[model samples]
Target: MAESPKRDTRDTTPDPKGRTQDRLIEHSYDGIQEYDNPMPRWWLTTFALTIIFSVLYVLNIGPIGAGKGWIADYEADMKAFAAAHPAPSGNDVSEGALLALVGDQKALAAGKSTFDAYCASCHRQDGGGLIGPSLVDNYWLHGGKITDIYKTVVDGVLAKGMPPWGKSLKPEQLTAVVAYVVSMHGSNPPNPKAPQGELVTP
Candidate 1:
């Protein structure tokens, strides 16, 4: 009989440097085996850095974060803007000045234009009142004085539904609209809403 071939046995186990040999996982599928290897240190480091960066970014913005949040920043910017461009003073105008505009046909025309665009929806085109109280009647909800009317337009009645027009309307527009409203007093329209509020004598 021929002599049996000598069996050569060199260590197949992986060395401490992990370069000696590849270690196969115990499980196999369809005679295929996978090497048990760890992820590269560079790839893991990059993933960890991304997670840290995201956490820092969140903590620096919005209302929840450590930084002066977006709400505070927005409020500061608004304050600066208001300081730079101050609103026209309502107290400066006398009742006489506003009354004078009532006789000005040119002013009345502009006022009417603005009223038709904005006020007409609530107080009808004829000022007979629809959703709002009648302007043609002597009934005064806030007050009937021209100055009172000006304050109403500027400050608005929040309890009701009217919005403050001071910030939205230009100074001239506010003056003109108030003048138009004043001019409509006592000129009765065809069909008016039932009188509401305290009746004031002119």
Candidate 2:
């Protein structure tokens, strides 16, 4: 018996639309065959757009093509926020204001609550020092003046592991805590840490 003639699978012929007709691939397995069809125009366009977008994204380029990039954009946003809501500064509160709070029982109670929640872990409940220096002692690491203490609390000693509470705490809480610390001066809490800084008269 003669072998069957091979089927024509060439894609050279053009269709009525003047586009090459998709032809079946020559090889087949179990009588299964497939055509070499080009992807749809819309799909190809979408794929190309995705590639362009990926390149722009990798370069941190903004929508306008010419921009400061994502990092700069983020920094600008942060600066705007800071300008709109400035961090509490030492100058914002006066020493007399803080001293007045020191004598206020309600303010002192609030301060003690805040201190227990945030500061007790480092300074101990009695302000005798733990990881941080003693608050009850005459020696001051940053300063002894009430205003100086306010600055320290607002700015924080990052090198010494104290966080700037000005950003986290309310303005009232900051002043209250400072007042509470002032009241702790000369407290002579038991087992106080050795004086870390120069002695300052209370």
Candidate 3:
């Protein structure tokens, strides 16, 4: 067989050390030139997070790092939120303003949400007020009325260490809670608290 030609092995490209692969811009006064290299993924993520935190920090502060009654503002906002959200009375809003909140499915749902959050601690999941009063029945310990229950929840009995919730909860939320109580009268649940006060038969 005839001998085959060998490929050229000699290096022809100049040793352009530190030069960009795409070649530097034609003009260069100082020692700066834009690169064609794509930005790294990690760098992009870091920048995005920095922007997000800046926005969050600004919302919680007034200026110069001062919170400026941030807590009070937060509490007020929460109250407004509760009122606007209004407990779902299952769209069953009936009766006058006081009793209107009661018997409504939506209002009951809202009441259930709030009751579980705060009352459940003292009063078991059932209407039985643990360390509190049994809510399963008509208990007149504090006159039972959509208004009475609402007032008690808001004003709270200082003697019982039940601090006023008016500052913590919106009026509508309180109404929803009372609505739930009214709905629970005479209902059965697991391990219901002993019947207390006047057995309010709904």
Candidate 4:
């Protein structure tokens, strides 16, 4: 019979606290000892889960996490919202209806308020020309028709100093303003500024 080689045996088991009872000892020259302790099952499991979750989120390959993720979703939502709430149409006010507002005292008052708030800096409170041409005079740089006035108020003349008041004022407010301007015809102010532009029919 051949001689059997000697084998070293060591017990490896868990303690009551679930920690490994047998620690692997590392050799050191100065007698300072080091042992290898297995990480707790719960901690290892949690660390693995975290790594997996981070990979899934960062890769953007999964169904729910695809594309730009939350940012893409936010953009889609905002675009949908804008499509739902469109801007007011110019057709909301008719030329005939807008013309009717000229005699309306309440409408005129509203128009006057808007004009004072916005137009007074250029046109003056009395409709006499300041930086802008006289609103009271028959002469109009732009045409004098209700449609012409509407376009001017909405789009504005950048070459001149006037800004588009339609953006700041509501459609109804703009209609009222046009009415007030129409009502100003033929009533000359005391110190009327020099007349400018060709005369046109309202």
* Each candidate's clash count: 0, 0, 10, 0
Ordering by TM-score: 2, 1, 4, 3
For model 2, the superposed segments whose C-alpha errors exceed 4 Å read 1-78, 89-92
Q: Cα deviation of 29 in candidate 3 (Å)?
A: 99
Q: Which of 3 and 4 is the better model by lDDT? A: 4
Summarize candidate 2's per-residue lDDT along 78-149 as a digit string, tens digits: 999889867876544877778889999999999999999989999999999999999998899888999999
In model 1, which range of ten residues has the least summed lDDT? 2-11
- List the candidate 4 regions with Cα displacement exceeding 4 Å: 1-87
Better of 1 and 4 by lDDT: 1
> Tens-digit lDDT track for model 1 on 32-58?
757667799999999999898677555
Give the top-scoring candidate (lDDT): 2
What does candidate 3's lDDT look like per residue over 1-202, in tens digits? Answer: 6534533343334566844344333333355545345578899999998898677666764442544456657788889988985543433333366476665788788889998998888777787667887777666677776667766777788897787777677767777887787777777777766666664444
lDDT of 4 by residue, 15-37 (tens): 88987567645444356745566
- Could you say which candidate leads in TM-score? 2
TM-score, prediction 2: 0.60
Q: After superposition, how far is residue 97 of candidate 4 from its true place, in Å?
A: 0.9
